[model samples]
Target: MSGLAAGWASGAQGRTARSPGIAVTIDDFDLTDTPLMSGEERDAAIRAALARHRVKAAGFVAGKYVGDSLDPAVLARWSDGGHILGNHSFSHRYFGGEDPAGFMADVLKCEPLLSGYAGFRRLFRFPYLAEGKIAAGRDTMRALLKRHGYRNAPVTIDTSDWYVDNRLKARLLADPRQSMEPYRRFYLGHVWERATFYDGLAQSLFGHSIDHTILLHHRLTTGLFLDDMLAMFEERGWRLVDADKALASPLLAREPEGLPAGQSLVWALAKADGRYEGRLRYPGEDGAYEAPRMDALGL
Candidate 1:
């Protein structure tokens, strides 16, 4: 009857014409420089890509990364462009490593810095996506979030852009003149594989497509490759939507039943269902698929 419903039916019927929607949310707004460029330069490149694509992202800022120097200006560039800013913790400490109270304090400490931005929203993505070690710890943090009126940001398409950036940074530092073709190919293929898997999982679990929230980072690799990444998504038929729209998916409201609960919401939900546990990958965020290739390339 409705266009969306009709599209869902077509997808349900195994039509290849339907494509999923997704939004980009970048984490750890650390402006530290990489071997190829200064922090400002990297930020400029990322901004340029966002501008060219006319895309706005939700940038979660770690207060520890912001200071009196050039960091505020970098944040301004994002907020000034109508991008949303969210809390990413003060010290980027893992909740599992620290007590629940300590972790909440770390989250609260970052609020002022996030509130300083005009686009600040009461959305919080965990450091390392580490919510807690057990049920009690997870519940503790959830209660704290409710009291503070913060929405927990859930990533649907999780990626390891940070690890790739680390390896790329190391290689660039070793030899700036080395060709980047191998790195680019590996990055694109790896991301594409993950995206396909997650999108398929969403369809299988929900009987239709849900807006996917992708987890990326503020790093040299993304700054260098995001434009191409977005292009690849476009070519694959994905329609990029705003972060808020993606996060508003009703599917995100369901809390999974177990502990060690820091993962993409999709993965957590699948685990809760227990029907597709075998499909779920452990330590969902890593560069294992690309590690050997990177090693062989001498990166």
Candidate 2:
């Protein structure tokens, strides 16, 4: 086995005791208006929540969402608020079916906008968490990122916050005066469930908890309840770490030999281990998986 693979095998024997840690990483600086809030209002709300909690997050910028207009101001607020910004690709295309060369160009295209920010980092997150479907495409993209001095920002705790936000928006449009408590309840519960599950999976595979990066998006749900979400983690004894510190975990740098290359890093590592098949699910977290449950609950 390769050194990294061996290290993973050795750690899987027993669980190591440690406190859980997580950092918030928001994606897609989509400045489009939503049902409940205007684009600028949504941006202000998210930044306000972060400031209120004194938490520094990493916002991944999708070039397509940003333009010559008010978009730069929206991103400027994030950087000025002590948050880090990373590239999420210009077109935000799924790398799985994309040509490697084209995808690299897309990633490069987004860097200029972020470079002006003091908080910008040479971190790149795969759009949709889909790295590539084949080994060649994956390796090619990896080389491009490495060549550009960019590290792949792997998410460990993945949640479908965007999906929940969609549902909440739909509800609000149907009746703006309706109670938002149910949406809050569902969002918090969904996040906690994914957080614990991924944390447990990491513990089982690594024998300890690694600093986790939870995937969240810039949306109405997040803008409305990010403070609550951060508080929820703290109340549950999970340490809220900075995105820079969380992404610094050495484990996040290790490449798993799993095919179709990406999802949550923890999920990929578990797949490469070949022992957690029964507990694993393809496409780790998705709206489809939560739809029935949400529907059943009338959420």
Candidate 3:
């Protein structure tokens, strides 16, 4: 969880591209056995939603989670349907509980599964967001990506649903006052806040149009609330592309011949400017806009 404060650093040279269309991506697709339903069952629900809303979503799945082994058939459904598979690691450890090398190994171990997905690969999303867990951990991970011929996936907006209790329908079920309960914080709210945060962030960052990789969990609660979530997408008129498209990171301009992915990374944490002006990834946040303390990033 400390990764929340410390993300890996990367130095991609690609100019930032923002579009009015939204790119929706969901994580932990193979993650089941909880308040949410099974991955297969969830897929059905998701398909129904896609057809209902005419929007497509990217499913970031664990290669090993499908039948506890690399099941190509299961993975194919997603790719065949035009949904992409994202890497989430072989084992879903709540806490990575190791150093950069250990963390990299944990993620790399799942490469077989990731690469096995329809033979079209090149994207990775940290389980629970590596950026937040280890400061500049994104650097270590990015190095891995470069070596493996993959790219870093950055999430512009995130939903806190997975971390909290299973209140999948809380916002929908909430009364006016209950809805306001989650909004005690100035910028964050309970029910409408998740959607509101992305919607507003989208408006502010790209002004109602931009390619965004949003982090959402594939869980029973989210599955239950799928209808409500899709409604917002329609209201916003965003085109749902495979979430993998969002992993566009800055690359080295020189394009060195044989650099390891770890060697290619910059290793810094990204900080959001409070004024909505711009966001910068730094080693640390200092005095509101400077680099933050690495110690705070769990680096």
Candidate 4:
């Protein structure tokens, strides 16, 4: 077995005794694309939230969105304030079904844009968590990333913030006066639910909580509610830590055997384990847990 696999095997014998902490990573900086909040407004809100929480996060940029809808100044704001920046692919294309060569090229396309940012880290998070449909595509990308000095920014806590944003946006558009209380409750509940679920998975796999890298987006929901989200996490006993430190968890190094290997690395590793078969959730992105609750709340 590879060293990483061997380490994982050894670690699996018992969980490490450590406190829970999380680093937030935001992807696809399309802040200007939203009509709900002006670019400046979104920037101010995000800045305020980070300051209020006294935390820093890593933002991944989609190169194509740079001049189209994403403002370069916005990225500067985050990096300047001690947050990190990384590539989110050039065009947010799914690696699955994509030509590995072209995908590598796309990733390279974003390096120029991100390389100058403060705290710019050599990290890359797969768009849509779709690594590849098969081993060749997945393996080729891994090799390319290694050759290019990039590390996979694997997520541990993956929630459906984007879907909730969509539902919230539709509601806002239909009635400007509609109460957001239900949306807020549903959003917080959904995130807490995912956190609990993934924490359980980590405990089962490693015998203790592993530092988590949370996958959230640069969207309206986050810009408006991130402070509350951070507060909720703290209330739940999860400390907010630096993105670089969180990604350093030994759990992130293990590339378990799996096809289209791009979900939370934790989920992928769990799925790759034969013992976890029939016990894990497939396509871990659905809103089935929150949909019914939101619908019942008349949201």
Model 1, global lDDT: 0.79
Give the backbone clash total of model 1: 0
TM-score per prediction, in order, is: 0.91, 0.92, 0.61, 0.90
Ranking by TM-score: 2, 1, 4, 3
C-alpha RMSD values across all candidates: 4.9, 5.4, 10.4, 5.8
For model 2, residues 87-181, the per-residue Cα lDDT tens digits are 99998888884589888988999999899999899999999999888998898889888998999999999989989988888888898897889
Could you say which candidate leads in lDDT?
A: 2
Best by TM-score: 2
lDDT of 4 by residue, 94-114 (tens): 778458889989999989988
lDDT pick, better of 3 and 4: 4
Return the TM-score for candidate 4, rounded to 2 decimals.
0.90
Candidate 4 least-lDDT 10 residues: 2-11
The C-alpha stretches of model 4 lying farther than 4 A from their native spots are 1-17, 33-36
lDDT of 1 by residue, 1-299 (tens): 22222333322244345468878899987787777778899889887877877778888888888895346888888889988899999988778834788888888999998787788999989988887878888988888888899889888888887878888888888888977777888787667666667776777788766778899898888888988988877765678787877777777666776668878888787777788776777877787866877798676
Clashing pairs in 2: none
TM-score winner between candidates 1 and 4: 1
- How many Å off is the CA of 113 in candidate 3? 2.0
Off by over 4 Å in 2: 1-17, 68-70
C-alpha lDDT score of every prediction, in listed order: 0.79, 0.85, 0.48, 0.79
